[model samples]
Every structure is written in structure tokens, then in C-alpha cells.
Target: MDYKTYKTDDFLFDESFRQWTAGTSPEATAFWEQWLTQNPDRVHVVRQAQELVRALNDHYQDDATDARLTSELRRLVRNAAERREAEAADTPSIPLGQRISPWRWASVAAVIILLGFGLWRYGNVNRRVAAESYTHLTKTAQVSLQETVNTSDHVVNILLSDGSAVTLRPKSRLSYPAQFKATTRVVYLDGEAFFDVVKNPAKPFLIYANQTVTKVLGTTFLVRAFESEKNVIVTVRTGRVSVYTQQDFEKAQQSGLRRIQGVILTPNQQMIYNLGDHQLMKALVEKPAAIMPETVSREQVFEDAPVGKVFATIEQTYGVKLLYNDDDLSACLVNLTFTNESLLERLDVVCQTIGASYEVLDGQIVINSKGCK
Candidate 1:
């Protein structure tokens, strides 16, 4: 029987696989689907790699029995000494009985000792690597935990083992196992993240956000759950996502807490759930306009939009918070085509058009209307 041998490089694919299993980059997660589509053979390879990593993690978690580590170190040192002795004997040098200067003999011994030490150190490093390779091995039923968070101005990308990608927003945190198991790809998230999930109908991607759980099989969407906000928002830019309440899952589960009240969101739709009431609302969003459009002419326009509505739109589009000092001012209408105004300038224009006054207060614009027009 003839068998083909595969080198370690044959497993280069495992690097990306490990990253996904480790739940690191959102960009990697986004590419997962396309990669899987292109390289179908990698599916099996990735699964095997995940299993191997999980096993290694488990093995390392176990406590060492005794002084085995110390004993190994000692053995390594002795091996080095013996190798040095052998090399000294094999080298052609001054005769053993020749009357040589003390310094020359010392120099010869010192050179041999240094060479021996180098070999021993090299061997020790290899031994450590070997020991660490299988240190984290685990059996079935053990759970692994992995987490990643990005709180920068720039978008943070992650690639999953299955070739999916996730883009996390500032102040966002996510956690998953170092390796995925047979059943599903589960992740826990807090704050906000945008997922471009890979399609894997067999193994669904589950995102646990606060009390809500979002499940998707190959989709693109945005999820926001802020500690200060009363609602968790799920916006599906492409594909679909099922948003469920914690109670719904509790009812479904016989013993543990289950999530309840879930709705599937199609492209250009958003689901907003109130944490206090556990109520879910689905709204049809006009094809989501870019958050910040470079050309103002292409952005949403208001002929005579209410001041409140206009402000809300600006807040939503620019991700800023606005405040109104007087109810009368909020009801005032404004007509404006604002495309290139800085956020503050935009607010000033709106206030002037509506016969209202505004001041920046605590990073928010507060509007005071003299009277509704």
C-alpha cells in the first residue's frame, strides 16, 4: 500500500482557520463565505483544524502531575554536556598528554563548552514546542471561550473559521470559542457590530447580544446594543437575520432561560426591541442611504420637514445625539437642502429656518423655538 505524505505547509490554510475559530478579525469572517464557495475542500480541512486546536487548548488547561517539567529541563542539560564531550573527542587538536599552555587548554575547553551550550539551548526550545503543542488537548463537552473588542475610530474586521467576516464598531466587544464544535458557531457580543456572515445552512451563526440573540445563515446586517440605549437595534443591509427576545428563548427551553419574541428581517428592514417591555417593532427602511454621503445632493432632502424629524434624521445619519429645549420648536417645520454643511452648521441652518435658537450642550445640540411657524 502506498500513502502520500503531506507537509506542514499543506496546512497553511489552518492559519486562517485558527483565526476564525479564535474569533479574531471581522474582515476574515466576511471572506469566509466566499472562500468556502471557491474552495469547498477547505470545509473539511477547517473543521479538522478547529478540532485539533480545541483539543490542544484542553490539554494545556489540565494541571501538571508533579516535577515532570523540572525533570525534563535537567535531562536536557545533561544531554548537552554529553554531546559537548563527544564533539571535543572527535575534533583533531593538541594531543591529550602534550604539554600545552594553561591558557590554550582553557580556551579550547571554553569553545567546546559554548558549542555544547548552544546545541542544548536549541534542543530545549524544540522540546518546549513539542510539549506546548499538545498541552491544551480537550475531550468532548468542554467549552472554549474567545473574545475580541474594538473601540477605535476605524472599523475592526474579523474572519471566522467558516470564512465569514464581521466588522465591529467602536466600543464593541465579541467572544467565541477558540474552535467551533459540531453543532453551531456561537458568539457573544456587546455594543455594536456589522456582520457579513458566510452561508452555512447546516451550521447557523448565532450572535448573543445582551438579552437578545440574533441567528443568521449567510447574511449582512448591523447590530447595536448600547448600555445607555433602551432598545437593541438590528438592521439588515443584505441577507436576513432572525431577532429574538430573551423570553422567547426561555419559553422554548424547558429548564434554562429562553429568548422570546423574534422576527426575521429582510434586506432594507430593521428590528428594534425595547428591553423593558420586551416589545419588538419591525420597520421598512427606504434602501438605507449611506450613513454619511459625500455628495449632499444625493442625501435625503426635506422640503418642509418638521424640525424634530429633521433633527432625528440628521442624528441617525451622522450618529449624533440632539436635544430640544422647547416642545413648540420641535413642531416647527424647516425647508433646507443640506449636503455639505458641518453638523453644527447644519443645525444652525435648521434652527434659523424654523425661527428657533440652538446651543451645543454636552456634545448635543439643544433647540429652543420662539414659536411654531
Candidate 2:
């Protein structure tokens, strides 16, 4: 079978894929792992299908639920074949026992486990489901949306109606409206994407990803919320953005609250939302780029400059706040040359010179020392 065109639903129904997910057939496992290695773009779809298979397997642990779903699946298959036969005969067919549910072809177990009430019944089975699943978000959105899937190896650019641009990475997908609502421009993302939002203070731009909602007026940021990953990361490149838990966003909407509550990230900062414990952590990006390099002195040399002055320059250049005892650090002096060194590297030199240590706390660098003579 040409698995390239197969979607999540198709993979969920494929016996070989199911076997590979269940680890029942060694041949299936070898084939799928090698296939995934060769076709890396399908990793997202394969992961989703694997999760569905595991969910069904978990549900089947309950014998009663298993029997019911098994019976339902057989019945649905029979009805589908009968309907096909009826169509071939050119006869008006009877209703196929209540129009085939949207996902009947995949697995009845999926419907049983993913339904609203079903989720409540299954202890924590729904935890495996990613918050950014295309079907999940689109169905719950209650608005018309157009979905763009990036199947190629290269990044795909999507221009939203709101003049925003999204750089969708390979194997990722974006669902957005042809035209945004008057109040807000909302988009749903399932994988990795970089968003360059246009400034519109009136209508905020919101991105719904795994367990997190990123709100921006106008900024450039990258969001990584892949299903296989445990954390949802929002890294800001320019401007500012507010990151909120998906639960908080819904609560604010229902309460008609106008205030935005969440972690506010500026340039060179990032927010990591852990899906397991639902913790939101703010930290600096791996490589901190100078935000205002042009404003710094052209000489790029500091001679006998007060430590506070050096820290001020560093803060101004990187746009990151540094915490230190003003009096303790003010007595220190530093002789340093700043060329293209990173923010942390500069901090290291300054800290070493003053016999102080620096640690990152809540996205801010804090200098630790008793007093610098």
C-alpha cells in the first residue's frame, strides 16, 4: 500500500500499522520503523495513529467495552459493504444505521474513548491526546476553518487573511479561518510554526497549540507543540507575547473578562508549558541574540567601567533583565571587550571578574555575591 497518501485515520485502520503499534508483529515493526526513517514527514501522522491504537488497546482491557466496540465495528463494516453493493446495483439504499459517524471507518473504540462523556469515564486516557489535533480543534472550534498541511520536506508559508504570515514546518499543519472574526484572529497549530503577526491592538492574535494559547498584538515568535513532544514552547524573536494555559483562555472567554492573564514574554525569551504537570516556565532562548546591538557603543570596549554600568549595557543590548544587589555589584569594576559574545558569555566574564556567580531565575539572570571589594 502507498502509505504516503494515508492520513491518521487511514493509518489507524491499517492492520500493519496497528500491529506495529501493538508490537505484536516483528515484521510490521521493522517495516514501519524503516518506513518512518525514510519518510520523516509522516512522523506526525504516524504518532497520532499510534496513540489512537494504544487508546483503543487500553479501552479493550475492559472486556465489556471491548465486546461492544467489536460488535459495533463488525456491524459498521457490514453496513459499509452492503451500502457499496447497493450503490453498484443502482438501487435506493436504506440508511446505513444512522449516517456513518465521522470516524466510524477508523475504530469504534476511538469514538468510545474520545467522546466527551467517554473521556470523563476513562480515568486519564485522554491525557495522551494532543491539544492541537486537527480533528479535535476543528470540531471544537465551532467556526469554519481551512486547514493547511505541510507534506513537503521544506517549510511552507501560509498567509492568513489578517495579514499575518505563518512558516509551517514539515509534517506540521495549521488550521485557520479564511477571514478572521472581527474581535480576534485565531489559528490552530499541531506541530512547529513561526508566526509573524501584524500589529492589531484592537483585535488580538491568538494561537491555540498543545495545552497553551499564545496571544500577541504584533510579534514574531516560534511555537513548537508537536504531538510527540511533552512540552509546548513559545520563543519570541521580536516584540512581546502573552502565553496562557488553554484552560485559562476558556475561562476568560466564558467570564467575559477583558484582562489577559499569563506569562508575558519579550524578545529573546521563551515560555515552556509542560503538558504532564501543566507548569508554565519562562526562560531565555538557547541563543540570546542582541536586540539593540546598533544602540551600543561602536568601540565595544569597557575599561574600568562599574559593574552596574556593564550590566546596564548588557541589559540594553539583550533586552533581558538582570537582578543583582545594586550596592554589592556597584563597587565592582570590569575591563572587558564585547565583540560578538552571547549574553551568557558576557555575564560569565563579569561574574568571574567580580568573584560572583550568576544563575538564571524566572528568565532573569541573578548575580550571587556577598559584596565586591
Candidate 3:
């Protein structure tokens, strides 16, 4: 007979093997006999697989072995006795009772104990998988702001309960509730963040940045409000957003005070608030210069400009630093056109042009123009 190869799914084969080893069913015995005859040369492969199953059963059968093992052993013995009687009817010359070995009886007892333990462990894993499938829900209430800081420059992404995403920029702080309540989705932002909110017409998403509050049904926008800065800036990249003050709402509702209060922003529009005077100004949004062209031309340039102004220009343009010796050259100025040079190289040319010299102290470039025209 040509040997037939059997390809089996690992899980199905393991489960079937476990059931087969527990007792001698006619189906189980037939399968084992066919498998052995097909690959008689590889009989040890079957033994190794069976041994692994037995070891697992032995490990887990420690608890309740007296009750479970005794019951399982009795079932195995009865099955073996029935198999012997069936064999006697087919082969009259072979003595059925004398065919069994002591070792074969021991193997049957071991297999039954293993099968009981395997079933118990399989039940435990299923229960754990079911328990882990449930989603975590939070109670609704007024919760304190939870602040998360990412010291590294990596962008931090968070998913709100309302299915919105907020990406915080580097060196920024954002605070929101552990769970959103019925009224609105409120978040407090300091520094900068990019928001992609989910739309719910009934409940608006409000971002409180310093004195100004930005409200929207759903929109994508960027907000920057540094602590020392006098203005809170909101730039809308897409969708619509409304900007107004807390006082603006109160004033608009007054019986006698009837000035138009809220500012609705369209795409590519920005709102700036003067923190000192509580004035809100709307302007067509211009891309920030740092993100714009490297070489922005000026019609006319100033010669020997104030050191402070020069440092500010360098910081804004190439996002670099300039340190100055306060006592030596705080009032010193340089004459230069910063057209298309790397930041450090530009600083070098500026120092040379003004007959001044500079040295890098820490990450900042310090200028010392003590005695120069």
C-alpha cells in the first residue's frame, strides 16, 4: 500500500490527539493504526507528540488528582477490556487477555489524567480572553485637568472619548477631562496643538487658550499661546472655527449692550487677541515666516541696526540664537543683509562687516563689538 500523507491544522490535531489519548474509541484506535502504518519508519514522531501532550497533562493534574484521575482511569480500563473482547472475536488463535502488557496499562492511566488537566487549562484561557474583550468606560463628572508632558520632541497623539484626536506639539501642555460630559468637549491648551475634532452639532468642542476661547462643531486648526506672549493666535487650516472672549458672550447678552461680539473664521483666516486690552483682531492668515521662503527681500536695508533687532531677525528666520555681551556691546549694532546664508555663516559675516567679533558661548552666538566703528 502507498503511504498517505496527512496534513493537519495544529490546533485541531492537538485537540483531537488529547481526546484520543484519554480513551480507546474505535475511531481513535483506527486513526492511530492508519497513521502508524503510513509512516512505519517514523513511529518515534508519534511518540514524541504524545509525550508532549502527556507532560502538559501531568503538570496540571496535581490538583484534584485523587477524584478526577481515579474516575478517568476507571473509564480507560473499561474501554481497554472491551477492545480486547472485540480483538478475540476477529483473531481466534491469539489469546486476547494475554496480549496486554503492564507498560501499556500504565500508559493508558497516564493519558487519562493528562486529558482531564488539559480540558481544565483550556477553560481558563477562554475565560481570560472573554474578560479582556470588554471596553473600559469612565464615569461622567467634572474632572480635574490631566496634564501630559513629552520632554522629547516627538509628537504626542491622543484619542478622546468622543472619537477626536489631539496632537500636541513639542514643549506644549494640554489638559482635558478624563471623560467628556453632556454639555461640551472642553480642553485647555498652553503652547501649541493641532486638533482634528469629531462633529456633533449639539455639543461644541471648546479650546480655552489664555483669555480667548475657540469653538467649533468639527474642524482642523493650530493654536499657539505662549505664557509670556501678549496674544493668543488661532489659525484654521480647514473647516470653520469661532473665536470670542468669555466676556464677549456676557456683553452680547446684556439688554442694553448690543455690539456684535463673536468672530466666525473661515479657512485660511486667523484671530489674534491682545491680552492686555482684551481686544480681538481678525486678519487674513499669512503663513509664518519661518515656514516660508529662506530669502525674503527687503526694499531698503538699515545699516548698523540694533543688536536686539538683529538677534530677533536671526531667531525668526533660521530659528537660531544670538547671545551678546551685555556690558561690552548691548547697544552695538551691525550693518548686514541676511540673504541666503546659513545662520551661523550669516552671523560670521555680520560680525566681520561691523568690525566686531563673536564667539559661541553654549549654543548661543555672543557678539563683542567693544571698540569698532
Candidate 4:
């Protein structure tokens, strides 16, 4: 399928997309990941379509009332037809055809016990049917739980029914559903895992660990909530993720689900939830990777580029915003050429050239310096 030009709805309707999003098909995931890397602009739209699919695939319900009504209608039609047939057979006067013989009376006596048992059996048949159907309904209502315990020395590749892939580190455990409900996809995490979640905007993906909960629509991220550690940490890789305490669920309910009432983390950002203090610390990752990689072949090189232009290019390539402490540093032009340097290296050159310094604040690069003429 030519998914390149497909909108959100188109992707939702495509079975291949479903399989891909569900993470059930490894081939589809590889194809999709490659396609996304090649066509970065489509990532946002694809994520939206993925969300729509999850939201719509809830466990279905069967309406017993409708079924009963259909059966009653059929019975009524059959009775009316039988009445017409009787009238056609005799019109005004139907003759009594036969008198009960002595043999028939004897036969009734012969089967009297059997007939009584049959009547009793018939009375209980409907109740049995109701009970069986109720059992099926109950089974559906109760979620099919599945658990993965990684005992291997290497990380375990666990594929969730909803298509999210979890790379569970050794000695970790994850509990999730065999089938997800329509509203939300939840999984319990203990220890460390990296999740490459398929996007389903309508149904958000949640990872609950100890007292912390990490939620996202669709993103690549990591969660570390080992029983040995006192803090639960969540780090974003590709998209946005939100982290909050379990106690704040009431806050979400009171405020409504319209807004995320938690600390939001963008790509290359991480949030650590301190179990003791009950506080969350948001900061940049130790080694922050670029949001978008610079293809070595199509690398961009600047020669004597203005500092503002340089900042804009960095923002475009990596999607990281840069804020100037003052207008003086913002206007100060720099002379430099950059090729294949890491984003930080490029930023360091730009800042050093203008005798300024930069720091990442809330996933943004903030330049700090006195005025440079």
C-alpha cells in the first residue's frame, strides 16, 4: 500500500497498518520503522491514525434484548401462518378426526414417568441457556490477564496485544492484558523496560510502577522502576510522555482528562520520581541524542552563518527550541562551519565564538551572555 500520502483515516482502515500498530507482525514493524525514518513528516499523522484504531477496538457487547425480540417475531409469524393453514383446510367447520383408543391410554401410562421428566428438563433448559450465556459475558467482562517474567540474561522482547513492544530487562516482570479494553491500555511494570508504543491517540498507553504512572499516546521511551531503587525514572526518546504520581489520579478525575496534570517530558528529557520526598525532578538525559538524526550523506554544513540562523537550523533538525537570555546574544552574529558535529558541539562552537554559554532548561537550549557588540 502507498501509505506515503495516506491521511489518518486511511491508515486506520488499512489492515496492514493495524497489524503494524498492533506490533503483532515483526515485518510490518520493520517496514513502518524504516518508512518513518525516511519520511519523518508523516510520523505525527501516523501516530494519530494509530490512536484511532486502539480507541475503536474495545471488547464488543451482545444485546440479549435484540436477540429475544427477533426470536419472538419469528414465532409470531409462524403461528399466523399455521392459523391460515388451518382455516384453509376446513374454512368454518373443522372435523374431529380421531378418538383416543385404549392403546393410546395405555401408551400414555407407559411414558408417564418419562413425560414428567421431560417437562422438568424443559423448564430448566432456558435457565441453563441463560447461565451459559451469562458465563460467556462474565468471561469477556473480566480482562484476560497475561504476565511476562524475564529470567534470561538478555532482555526479553515482549509484544503486547495492542502492538506496543516492550524490551524488558532481565529479572524484570510485566503484567498486562491479553486483549486491551477500548478506553485505555495499561500494563504494570517492575524493574526496567524500554517501550516502543504504537500510537493510539484515543486510547493512551500507561505504565504503572510503584507509585508513579507514565502515560503517552504513542512514543518510544524507557521506564526504570526497580524494586531495589528508591526512585522511578521515565525517559522520553522519540515523542512526548507524561509522568505523575498515582495519588494524583484524583486530580486528573477532578480536573477532567482534558489536560495532563503532570510533569510533561519531551524527547531526550527524563523525569525522576523520588519515592521518599514524593517529588518529581525533570532534567535532560545524561547523553541526549538528537530528535532527528543528521544523515551523514545529506549533512548540512554552514559557513559564517549568523547565530540566529544557526539556532533556527538546530531547532528545525532536532525540534529543540532555543531561548536567548538577552537580545544582545541573539543578535550577535558568529563565523563558523559545522558538519557532522553533535548538536551540543555545534552549540558549544556558536556560544564560544560569541563568548557566551548555553544550558538546557526544560528540554530547551537557553543562551546566557552579556551583550556582545
Q: Which candidate number has the best TM-score?
A: 2
Clashes per prediction?
46, 0, 0, 4
Residue 173 error for model 4, in Å?
1.1
Q: Is candidate 3 or candidate 4 better by TM-score?
A: 4
C-alpha-based local distance difference test score of model 4: 0.71
- Distance from true location, Cα of 124 in model 2, Å: 6.8
Give the backbone clash total of model 1.
46
Which candidate, 2 or 4, would have the higher TM-score against the true structure?
2
Per-prediction TM-score, please?
0.39, 0.63, 0.37, 0.58
Better candidate by lDDT, 3 or 4: 4
| Displacement of the residue 220 alpha carbon in candidate 1, Å | 0.3
| RMSD, one per candidate, in order | 22.6, 16.4, 23.1, 23.7
Report the Cα lDDT for residue 17, model 4. 76
Mind giving the per-residue lDDT tens digits that candidate 4 earns over 65-146?
A: 3344334334543454465567557765545565444334333322342343345445654453343232332344357667
User: lDDT of all the models against the reference?
Assistant: 0.62, 0.80, 0.62, 0.71
Best lDDT among the predictions, by candidate number: 2
Over the stretch 1-373, how does candidate 1's per-residue lDDT look in tens digits? 1101221212223445445655677766666656668767556545544554444333331232225323433454356557656876897796778745434443343344345434654575455433322122111225777667796888899887778788888887776677777778877677788888988899988876656778898888898976557888888876678888644553565566454457877655688888655577876453444344654446557887777778877766554456675466656767778766756677778877767777643324566667675
Please give the ranking of all candidate structures by TM-score, highest first, separated by commas: 2, 4, 1, 3
lDDT of 3: 0.62
Candidate 4, superposed: residue stretches over 4 Å from native: 1-142, 254-260, 295-299
